[model samples]
Target: MLATTPKPPYYAVIFTSIRTSYDKEYIETAKKMEHLASLQEGYLGHESAREEVGITVSYWKDLESIKHWKSQSDHLLAQQKGRDKWYAAFKTRICLVERDYGFEREEQT
Candidate 1:
């Protein structure tokens, strides 16, 4: 499902990663982080996809919100775990979404 974001000029944290063979704890941590993010201030919404590579994009109200999320203690731990156990490699990018448009087909009766 697409994330329901507010109007443009928001920040998006794009986390792209290649995972390791370790799967047990990683899935739990990922879900935990998503839940924790939902409880944070300035958190707009998030969407994620996984295949050979995984990508998670989280929307925020501002750069400050992004920074705060990074500094969050639980989030910090999750990051460390990602480095040590989950991800073989990863890149994070923050972008300002100045404009966005999309189309969803209506269900036919």
Candidate 2:
């Protein structure tokens, strides 16, 4: 499912990666990070997908929130694990979302 984000003026942390391999630990850590992010102070929402390459875009209220998430202890460990084991390569891009729009189909009974 797509993330339901607030109106404009938020931050988007786009994490794109090439995985070395997917293991049980990687799956568990990814789930943990998703849950932890949802509980954070300024987390908006996130959307993720994995195939040949993995992409996860997490939404935040501001840069401070993004920084806090980065420095979070478990997340820090996850980062190291990614470097050492999980990811062959990765790129993270933080951007200011100035404007946005989308369309959603209506639910039918």
Best by lDDT: 2
> Each candidate's TM vs. the true structure?
0.97, 0.96
- Candidate 1 is scored at a TM of 0.97
The candidate that wins on TM-score is 1
**lDDT (Cα, tens digit) per residue for candidate 1, span 1-109:** 9999999989999999999998877888888999999998999999999999999999999999999999999999999988888889999999999999999999999
Per-residue lDDT of 1-109 in model 2, one digit per residue for the tens?
9999999999999999999955749988999999999999999999999999999999999999999999999999999999999888999999999999999999999
- List the lowest-lDDT window of 10 residues for candidate 2: 19-28
